[model samples]
Each structure stands twice: as C-alpha cells, then as structure tokens.
Target: MPFFTVIIPLYNKEKYISNAIKSILNQTFTDFEVLIVNDCSTDNSIKIATEFESEKIRIIHHEKNKGLAATRNTGIKNAKANYVAFLDADDLWKPHFLEKIFNLIQNFSEARIFGTNYEEIWDETVKMPHNNSDSLPKDFVGYLNFFKINIKQGIYNHGSVCIHKEVFEKAGYYNENIQLSQDLDFNIRANYHFKLAYDASVQMSYFMQTDNQLTRSSIVNKTIPNYDAYEEWAKSNPDLKKYIDFERYVLGKRLKKNNDSRWKDMIAPIEAKNLNWKQNVLLKLPSSALNLVDKIKLLLLKVGVKPSTY
Candidate 1:
C-alpha cells in the first residue's frame, strides 16, 4: 500500500490544475496515490485533469456541486492510505514535500498530524508568514504546541499538512455546515486531541491569486465557524482561549466594518487581557472609521508596508 494518499479538492481551477498534478507526479517519494475529487466543475478543469493519465491518479466526480468542505470529506472517505495529505487544485508543492513529511512520520510516530512551513504567493511577490518558528533549529522535526504557535500566524496550511486517517475517526470529519473556516473548526478539534509533528522547512507554495477564490468573497455571506462550540473547553486551556480570542478579534473587525450585528456575538466571549490596546480601541470605532482604516491598510500593503492584522 502507498504510504500517503494525496487528496486534491477540485472545482473550476483549470488554469492551475496541471501544475498541481505535475508537482505530485514529480515528488521524490513516489509511493503515493493521487485522488482528485471533482465537485462538478463547469469549465475544462476535469478535461485538463484527465489529460495526464497515470495509474496512480484517480478522478472522482461528484454528481452535483458541493462546497469545499464536502469535497474534502469525499476525498477522506475514498482515501486508501493511512496518511492523507491535502493540496488544493491551485497550490504547488516542492519535490521534497512528501519526502520531508515522510521523515517526520518516521521520527514522530506518536503524532497524528504532520506539517511543514510554506510560502505564500501573491502575483509576483512571495512572502513568508509571521509564524513562531524563528527560534527553532534548522530542519526542526518535533511535536508542536499547535494552539500556542498558531496564535500569531498559523504554521500550517491545508496544502502543507498531512494527517493520519485516525484523526478523522476521533476528532471528526471537516464541518460541512460552513463553507468557510471549516479547516479552523477541524484544526481546533484535532489539535486539542493529538500532537502535531512539525518540520520547520518550507516545502510548499500557496497561490493566493487563484481564480474563483472563496476567500475573496464578502464576510456577510459566509457562515463563520461557531466558536461557541469550544467555549467550555477554552475556559480551562489558556492557549486555546487566547487563540480563539485572536480569531474573534480578527473576524469581529470585519463584521464590525460591515455593520453586522453578529460582530457583537463574535467578540462577546473574548477576555480583555487577550486583546491588545489597539484591538480594543479599534473595536469601539464606527463602521465608517473601520472602512477608512481598511483602505489605508490596503494602500500600505501596495507600497510594500505590511501593517499588523491585529
């Protein structure tokens, strides 16, 4: 049996599907199968995906359109390997991505989740996220304090992480109710139950400028994760509570700018100590002021100056 089952959730990503498939094909560690779960693409995505024929690649077609979370759940159910790795149809992995993750599995057998650092690509610019890996040793391979490290910038992306199948059995499958932040909901549960093996090596590229990107959509239309579900547990776990508070602060900012009443509920449970002085001040600002701040932030970003999201 293959050591890993690489699951690529596909929709209408025809322009980048070839590169995504090619990256998997070029992996140095070849004992893996590729499953492309197609969620009823209207474009030539399926056609392009089928052009590269190989025994290791299998394309599963859904009869109708389901969202990203459901598409991923389909891949998990169909996966044949004990370890499942997810790569979006628009992302690309380095040749050694699987090799490094395989090494992590051998070294940290107790960990159910394994991840590597990745670079974010936005048009011609490539930037590393502000993760908590700076103090770690080079080529670090060890279990991570998932919530603690994730409080600043997330160390793992959907494309850079590999999960043991048992994680799904215990922590549960991806939440299909929400179209967005499903990964966050699943990660909170998984990290709470299992240790995450992390290799502090950049082994993947997440393309942020892909066509049909769901993240580009407005915040009001999407169903955000129910942070209240973990409220009881977070009360005792400081790291998890702080992590959730940061998320609340970020989402609350967007909701406040949109003048959505849901913003109040989002930030109601957050502890004041968890938020910084700037975050507290910003929360009280009117929607028009928040909109002006957003425009200024965007302008700064264009000039290569990145203001902190907090």
Candidate 2:
C-alpha cells in the first residue's frame, strides 16, 4: 500500500485541477496515492481530472453534490494508507511537501498529525512573502500540544497537513452540519485530542480572491456562521473557553466590516482588560465608521499592499 493517501475534493476547479494533480505527481516523495473526489461538478473539472493518466490516481465521483465536509469524509473512508493528506483542487504544493511530511513523521513518530507552513497567492501577480523566523524552533521536532500551538500560531490549514487515519478515530471526522469554517472546526476537534506536529518550512500555496470561493463570499453570510461554529466548539472545550472572548473580539471586528450589529452582543462577554487601547477605540466606533475602515483596508489590498501575514 502507498505510504500516504492524498485526497483532493474536486468541484469546479478545472482551470487549476491539472496543476494541483501535477504538483502531487511531481512530489519528491512518491510513495503515495492521489484520490480525487469529484462532488458532482457541472464544469469541466471531472473531465480534466480524468485526463490525467497515472496508475497512482483514483477518482471517486459523487452522485449528488455533497458539500466539502461530506466529500472529505468520503475521502477518509476510502483512504487505504495509514496517513491521509488533503489538497484543495485550487492549491499547489511544493515538490518537497511529501518529503517534509515523511521526515516529520519519522522524527515525531508518536505524533499522529503533521503540517507544513504555506504561502498565499493573493491574485494573478501577487504572492505572500514567506517568513519562517516566527515559527516554532527549527531544530525542535515533536508534538506541540494542540492548545499551545493553536494559541500561539493558528491551526494549520488542511491542505498543508497529513494525519494518521487513527487520529480521526479518536477525534471524529469533520462536522457535515456546518457550511462554513468546517476546516477550523475539524482542526479544533482534532487538536483537543492530539498535538499537531508542524514543519516550519513553507511548502503549500493558498489561492485567494477567486470567484465563488467560500471564504471570499458575502462577509455577513460567512462571518456569522464562523462565529457560531466557534461558540459550539467552545461549549465542549474548556481549553478553548479562555480564547472565546478574544475570538469574539476579533470576530466582532470582522462583522463590523459588513455593518453587522451581530458583533455587538458577541463582544459583550469579552473583558475590557482583554482588549488593547486601539481595539478599545475601534470597538467604540459606530458601524458606519468601522465599515469605512473595512473599505479602506480592501482598497489597500487592491492597490498591491500586503495586509495579511500569510
């Protein structure tokens, strides 16, 4: 059997599917199978993915469109390898992705979850700068208990991770109920039971600002559900309880960009001491003023200023 089962949830990513599959096929570490789970795409995605002729490639087509969460679960169920890695159809990985993951597994044999740092592609021409100095110690290898890693550096993206199949047995699979932030929810749940092993080197790419992508959709529609997901996770996890107030504080700022009043109640539980002077000032602004700031931030991004620390 292959050492790793790489799962790609395909939808309408025909333009990028070939590159995504090519990235994996070119991996320095070749002992892996590429599983493409097509979610009933109405586009050329299936045809494009099928054209890639490789003995290591397997395609699973869904009879009906079952969103990302269910599609991922299906991939997990069909995974034959001990380790499972996820790749979004639009993202690309450096050639060393599997090599580094294999190295991490060998070094941290006891850890079940492993991830690599990633860069973000903002648009056609812009790319996020890679800075590894801010990551955990370079020489250190092992588990950073989920709570600490999450509190310090946010959870690793699924596209940049590889998890032992048994990890899902202990923590459970992605929640199919939520439409947004399912990735965050799954990571939080997994972290609750196991520490995530991380490789500081950058290896994966996140393509943002694409049309119809879940993240860049209507802010109000997406942001509200993400906050609700955070709440649901916080209810069962006391370790995450301490971060809820702070999470709410951040979520509130995001919601204000859409002139959303929902953040007002969300921020109530946060202590005044938790926020800094700037945060306090921003929180006091009217919705109109906050949205103006949001517009300015978007304008800056459009003008080629990198506002995000990828």
Candidate 3:
C-alpha cells in the first residue's frame, strides 16, 4: 500500500491542473498514490489529467456535478492509503512536501492530522506568507494548539494537510451540506477529537488568483456552517469558544454587508468581550459603508499591506 493518498478534487481547473499534478509527481517521497476526483467537469480538465502517463495517477469521475465537500468525500471514500492528503486542483505543493509530512508522521505518531505551512500567491506573483508564521515558535514541529494558533488565520491551507484515514472515522467525514467553511467545520471537529501534528515550514503554494475560488465568491448565495451545533460543547472550552467567535465575527461581517437577515443570528452567540472596539464599530456600519471598507481593504492588499479584523 502507498504511504499516502494525495486527493485533488477537480472541477473546471484545466489551466492549472497540469501544474498541480506535476507538483505531486515531483515529490521527493514517491510512496504515494494520486486520486483526481472530477466533479463532472465540462472543461478539458479530465482529459488533461488523463494525459499524465504515471501509473501512480487515477481519475474518478462523478456522474453529475457535486460541490467541493462531496467531491472531497468521494476522494476519501476511494482513497487506498492509510494517510490522505488533499491538494485542490489549482494548488501546488513543493517537491519535498510529502517528505516533510512523512517525517512529521514518524515523529508524531500520536497525531492523527498533520499539516505544513504554506504561502498564498496573489496576482500570480506576490507571495504572502500566512500571518500565523511570525507567531509560530522557532523551529516549531509537534502537536499544535489548533484553536489557539488558528485564531487569527489558519496555519495550514487545504493543500498542506495530511490526515490519517482513521481520522475520518472518528471525527466524521466532511460535512456535505455546508457549501462554505466546510473545511473550518471539519477542522473544528477533528481538533476536538485529535491532536494535529504541524510543521511550521512552508511546503505548498495556494494560488488565490484562480478562477472560481470559493473565498472570492459572494457569501449571499452560500450556506455557512451551522456553528450553533457546537455551541454547547464550546461553552466550557475557552479556546474553542474564542475560535468559533472569531469565525462568527468574520461570517457576520459578510452577512451584515450583504444585508442578510441571518446576520443577527450569526453574531448573537458571540460575547461582546471577545470582540474588540474595531469589530464592534464595523458591525454597526451600514451596508454601503461596509462595502466601501471592503474596497479600501482590497486596495491595501494590492499595496502589500495585510489588514485583518483583529
């Protein structure tokens, strides 16, 4: 059996699929299989994936279009290895990604989930390191305080994570019903049940410029995770409560900006003490004003100033 099963959930990413596949094929550690789960791509994505001649590659086609969560679940169900690593069709891994992950697995056998740091590519040129990198302890490599470290921004991107197959059995599969924040939902559940072995070395690239990227989509049409489901459990867990509140703050901003009636319910559970004066002020801003703020934030991003709600 392969040591790892790299699952790339595909849709219509024909332009970047070849690079994504090549990144995996060039991994320094070759004891892995690649599964490309195509979610009924009308584009030439499937054909492009098949053109790869490696015996390690396999493509699984869905009869109809399924969203990202379901596509990922399909990959998990079909995976043959003991460990599963997810790389979105548009993301690229460094050649030594699997090698470092293998080392993490050997060193932290008790951790069911493992992840490495990654950089985000903007405009296909500007590479931005995750905000959490500066806060990480020097030479950090071990079990992480998942909630504590991820409060500002998640330390690991989807492409940088490797999970033991058994984690799905214990924490549950990705929530198919959630169209947005499904990863955060799954990670919350997984962190609640198991320790996450993390390497603070950047081993992957998450291209933010890709077309149809979920983060760039409008939140009005999507279903945000029902964080209320974990409300009861988070009551006693301060770290988890803070983490969920931060997420609520983020989603609430979108809800408010869209003038969605659900905004009230989204932020209602959050304690005022958890939010700072700036967040409170932003929450009260009218939709037009919030939109202006978003534009300003984008301008700042373009100028290389990374702004955050915190």
Report the C-alpha displacement of residue 178, candidate 3, in angstroms: 1.0
Q: For model 3, how does the per-residue alpha-carbon lDDT over 28-66 read when each residue is reduced to its tens digit?
A: 999999999999999998899999846788889899998
Score every model by TM-score: 0.93, 0.84, 0.95
Give the candidate number with the greatest TM-score: 3
Query: In candidate 1, what are the lDDT values of residues 119-142, reduced to their tens digit?
Result: 877553736353444666666779
Mark the regions of model 1 whose C-alpha exceeds 4 Å error after superposition: 128-138, 210-215
By TM-score: ranked, best first? 3, 1, 2
lDDT leader: 3
C-alpha lDDT values of all predictions:
0.86, 0.76, 0.87
Q: Between which residue pairs do clashes occur in model 3?
A: none
Work out how many backbone clashes candidate 2 has: 0
lDDT of 2 by residue, 120-182 (tens): 676655676443435566555566755534533354577989999888998889888777667
Error of 1 at 282 (Å): 2.8
Q: What lDDT does candidate 1 reach at residue 163?
A: 95
Q: What local lDDT score does residue 181 receive in model 3, on the 0 to 100 scale?
A: 86
Q: Once superposed on the true structure, which residue ranges of model 2 sit more than 4 Å away at CA? A: 130-141, 151-155, 210-215, 219-239, 259-262, 271-283, 302-304, 308-310
